[model samples]
Target: MSDFSGIWIPLITPFADGAVDHAALRALVRRYADAGVAGLVALGTTGEPATLDAAEQDAVLATILDAAQADANAADAADATDAQRRPLPVLVGVSGNHTASMLARIEQLNSLPIAGVLIAAPYYTRPAQAGIVAHFSALADASAHPVVLYDIPQRTGVRLELDTLLTLAAHPRIQAIKDCAGSLDTTLALIRDGRLQVLAGNDLEVFSTVCAGGSGAIAASAHWRPERFVALYRALTEGKLDEGRRIFHALVPQIQLAFAEPNPAPMKALLAATGWVRNELRLPMTRASAALTERLAALGETLPR
Candidate 1:
């Protein structure tokens, strides 16, 4: 199975001048690479995949892969100690309600050098458990890369029940899961099963997940103070519980605030403060409110330099 452990950032697509900002996008990828993130998930929910058209989405992904390659080369030259310098593994997020369309999309991504894909349950339609099983099974069978199932019910409106998840875990192609089901029972059960790698989809759950014998996280809050996030992962992985808990405690407040304004808004606002990219989101998605921004700045002081 493909390893989906450690801290993975679901990058927010940087926009400027009413188009995808490839420059800022590449720089952001390089920054994460330097911080030694386990990998990155391109076009994930945080990346605003729904708002981007096919061409724009393709361009955004190309930029990230390109940056990963460049960062790998620099790391080799500098003899960097961390794995961040290596060609970072990249995961593409692919989801849809249409089975045929979703299968085609997975097939299309088979050619990329991605480690695997992060897929979600069919949304809105709320298909039966058997239908859901058939849906993901077919997609995983068609995909060349490993599959990481996403179980985020709040956004998808349907949950992949524990039985369904265990069944899917038996599939060779279906490897890991992004656990946003908000059910600690499911989280701990899946971890106990020890089949699929369980990655916490929520930022606030990263530390607890790691300490709970599950894998790391696919976090959006780590976009700002990424290295500290990495350190926490290391501390937990190395069994430094006290150290890990301390870092996690300090980061709890900011992590909560980042999602206070509907993801990627407050996150982008904080990133913009770093001058990495403008705090802009596409239509239907606005920037974090002025009040939220001010509150965020005050909380951001707790982040590591």
Candidate 2:
């Protein structure tokens, strides 16, 4: 099983002139690596991978992996010692509604230097608990790399129940879970179960989840407040709850605003306002409104670095 135990950013997709901006994407990847994120999750919900076509998804994944590999090489050269260098893992999110399609994508991605797959529970259709387990079990068995189950029921109508998750955890390939179950009960259950490593998919619950014995988080808010999130994880791991809470409270406003609208849109707008990425989303996912843009901009300015 893959030990996915750290703070990973579900990176934002960059666009220029209604296309995947490769240059901007490479720059962003390098920037995040420099910022000290534990890893990079490409084509995640924050990356708007669903909006992109199949060819676009392949292009984005190849570009991200290449860039990350190049950055690791450079850092290794700088250190001049293997002990001082660690290659940052690249996790590709290939989640969708269909199990067969997802399995195919995982097979296609097998050649890449990707560390694992982040599979969200089947979205829409709201499958039964048994269906959810079957879906993930198939993917886990098919995937050559480790599988991290994503349970963001708020977006995906189907929720991977505790019992189903326990069953899935028995599969050696199914390593961890991105627990966005939005409840402390499920989070605690996973921790107490003693097998699946829980990652807080919700930014607000990261500290408490870690306190409850979670591994870490795969937060969208980390796109803007990467350092703060990293600090919270560090503090919690260091047994400094007071210090973690102080930073967590200060970041609540930004986190709330980032998710105010549909994903990436709010995060894209905030990044654009700060000159990170262009505030452009594909059809169906529009940019944040003027009022929200202003609010996010103001909040970005006050966020603790």
Candidate 3:
């Protein structure tokens, strides 16, 4: 099983002229892989996957996988076998209200080289806990890769209750969770129980979660100062609380700014300033305000590179 621990970047899908920019996407994959993130989560909420058509999504995943493999090859010995080379793991996000569609999607992913799928509870329908359990159970059974349960109630409109979470954790394939449920008690409980590896989904909570013995994070904010985020996780896991706290404190300002506006806007704005990607988003989502962008740029300069 792939270890879903350490810091993972839920990538932002870069767009140019209102279309997916393969060049920018591949650049991001190489940058993060070099910076040492634990893995990458393509098409996560941060990636603006909903705006992308099916073909574009497939291309984006292919680009990420190809770029990561290329990076692995470049770093390893010439004679290194595939098993000896560490290809960066990438998790593709799959979420929806329909079970059969999700199952079919997972079935399709069975042939891909991705690490796993990140799934959330059914949205819009607001299924009851029983239904949520049934939904995830069926998906887990169908998935050839390990499952990372995404529990962001704000988006899903329903909480994965403690019982529901514990129930789902019993499944062999449901190995971890992206915990944005905003429940520290539940986070602690899962960490203590040791059934599922708990990865903090909210960027701000990464420190506390890792400190509390949770795994790491699937942080959107980490896209900015990814090395710092990785360092913070390393410090906390290695019993260096003071060092971890320092790194987290430095990153809090950026994290706050990243989410100051809804999602990838502030992040894209910053990346644009740095020429990493164009600051563009699809309809219903726009770029961050100029003021916020400037602030992110200035603060980004102050952060350790």
Candidate 4:
């Protein structure tokens, strides 16, 4: 498995003319590859995975793997006189309510070249912590790839309590977590517990998470200012607290606005302003406020995207 460390972009699925924009999607992958993110996440919450059909999801993952491979190959050719750069691994998000189907999904994904799977606790059902434990353990047991547990209680409506998390950590296949449970004590406890590699799923906490001895982040705000995010992670990992704080402080405003409205819309708006992708999204998911869109465009001028 690829190291679940450093910055990763939960890529937005770019849409255009009412269809998946493969050209723009590939461009986005190459953009992040050049920026040197640790990896790319596909079909994540930020990617609007809920709105895409199975076929669309499959295509998106394939495009990301292909682009990452091509980008790595090109970099090697360019620097053939030196050691080769490893292609960024792709992490695919898998979510479902039914355990059997979830396990089946993991089984299907085992055939792919992905590095791991990012899965949130079962949503809407509000299962007990024991049920949550069983759900994750069952998936982990069935999965051939590593599992990164996502604990965003707001969306899933039930916290994967710290005790439950500690228990799940014992599974060899459950290697890490996307820590969105919204508790500093929980975050710190998980870090100190020294079991699972805890990644900040909340964009605002990326720097704090890394500084607190957690792994890195699977950040949505990273869709913009990606290089700065990478720099911040590097700064923290190397114990340059002042440099890390400086980068985090500078990025706070963008992080706040990126999530001010619903996700990805504001993120996609900023990307569209930069001519990276169309500002379109699927039904039930709309674009950002025209007011915010203007601001994002202005903000885009300041970022290195």
Q: Global lDDT of each model?
A: 0.90, 0.84, 0.90, 0.89
Residue 35's lDDT within candidate 1 is 85
Q: Candidate 1 on 191-234: residue-level lDDT in tens?
A: 99999999999788888799999889999999978888999999
- Stretches > 4 Å off in candidate 2: 76-84, 303-305
Model 1 misplaced regions, further than 4 Å: 79-81, 300-305
Judge candidate 1 against the unseen true structure and give its global Cα lDDT, from 0 to 1. Answer: 0.90
lDDT comparison, 2 vs 4, better candidate: 4
- Residue-pair clash count for candidate 3: 0
Cα lDDT for residue 132, candidate 1 = 93
Among all windows of ten consecutive residues in candidate 1, which has the lowest summed lDDT?
Answer: 296-305
lDDT of candidate 2 over 1-305, digit per residue (tens):
45688789898889998999898888877777766777889899889887899999889988888888777677546553331155668888987788888888888987777889999888888999988888888888888899888988888987888889899999998888898888788889889997888999888888788888899989888888687778888898999989988988888888888889889889888888888789899988899999999998887687643
lDDT winner between 1 and 4, please give it. 1
